[model samples]
Target: MAETKTHRVTVAQRALLLSWAGVTDLGRRRETNQDAFLAEFPLFVVADGMGGHAGGEIASRSTVERLQAVVSAGDVNGPAIEKALEQAVGDIADHPETTDEGTGTTLTGVFFAITGDHAQWVALNIGDSRVYLLRDDRLVQVTTDHSVVQELITAGKLSPEEAEGHPYSNVITRAVGASELTAPDYVTIDVRAGDRFVICSDGLTKELTDYGIQHFLREHRDPGHSVDAMLAAALENGGRDNVTLIIVQVEDEDDSSSPIEDTTE
Candidate 1:
């Protein structure tokens, strides 16, 4: 078993702590893992690629690499991310592996930003990969899927249950490198302690339900353990596709106080 990698960052002004862990598995059926992720502070992302013959792998890896470079340069805002994603698209489109097959990848994750005295969590999504939030003991999907089945469900033509089993469930309407320009949906939320965020590829959700994920998160308080449990559950269910997940846990430093006692004992 390999050791899980963890990254921890702190918001200096507010003493808010953010810790994250990421895992990517080839799964039980895939010949190659086309999923890529970034778990660095202020920037975490998950990219699930499409197209076969290693095209997907190249697309996804290129997307994450571009984003990582942008983040390392200190541009961690919505517009900066969008620009990076656009460049990533061009990079993948120009690659030899994807030039003919037309490869693309889903990009989704959260970016931490601080403005004045307020700290915010920025959620970005494109395609079927998802971002979820577990707060107040409730787990809810933060990003909406941009897929054929998702559109049908929105139009009331299909129920969530039916859409899950639909043959075209994996047909995403939006993805990086799929077109000339790709605009991602972005939402900013106020950061709070005890807020747990999960960014993952569709492979994880396909195997585990929201309730199942929430149960695992609630059972494991540590981000590393939570990620391990969730990934294990997904593989156990049926590792149909490449599975990848990132778990971010926010904490308040002030909440760790302990009572003082007499000096001599």
Candidate 2:
């Protein structure tokens, strides 16, 4: 099931009406879902765990729980994120199963931040998971994947079309846990009206093309519907891996009301 919520935040006298939906599925082949997400106010994150057995699940769940605490503390910044990640690293290491299996997880998503003068979207990525933005009815990938295929593509060695069936497509260059932890690459985007952001794990990408993603987003106005539509398409397309995704829609307005939160299962 997808969990959906709405929030109205006021920052720098600016109002942003945000609605979002998130879901994680085991897919057709996976026995256990090693994906987790937190879709709370001021913060949204998706983590894709890697390793065998319960190691992956533990790594991902611990990471998101630590990050959720950071947001629950009432402030968010680079240092705070770093500290939270450090704590998450310790949590992952504490699990003997994870250490034995060399488990790890990919972290990615966006946070609602009030910078010095205005509101902005702070996107962060650590591995193959991705964050994309849809603005002006045009979709753009915001975070680059830290993977073997991505590195090859950037090096001009592997063409985008040829990289599709590459056996190394699943090999990520960075991760949170496993043997070590890596800092996330961060990006800031100025908030705008009618901006829609998609934070998803590579499982979704493995099944759907970019055009297919954009098409569904263009057809569905409600965040929950958008998430559901995409998830269904991914499963129908093979669902080769565990799938997890979040859709966040933002609208700008002056009539800022108190923060409102609601959930639908």
**Which candidate number maximizes TM-score?**
2
Question: Residue 168 of model 2: what lDDT?
Answer: 96
Worst 10 residues of 1 by lDDT: 256-265
The residue-by-residue lDDT of candidate 1 on 1-265, one tens digit each, is 2234444444443355567788999999999999999988878899999886878888899889988988889868878888888888778777877864458889999998766555678899989999999978888899999999999999999999999899999898888874556889988877677888999999999999999999998898888888889899999999999999999987776653221111211
What is the C-alpha local distance difference test score of candidate 2? 0.86
In the range 186-232, model 2's lDDT, one tens digit per residue, is: 99987776888999998999998889889999999889999999999
Clashes of 1: 0
Candidate 1 yields a Cα-based lDDT of 0.84
User: Which run of 10 residues does model 2 get worst, by summed lDDT?
Assistant: 256-265
TM-score of 2: 0.92
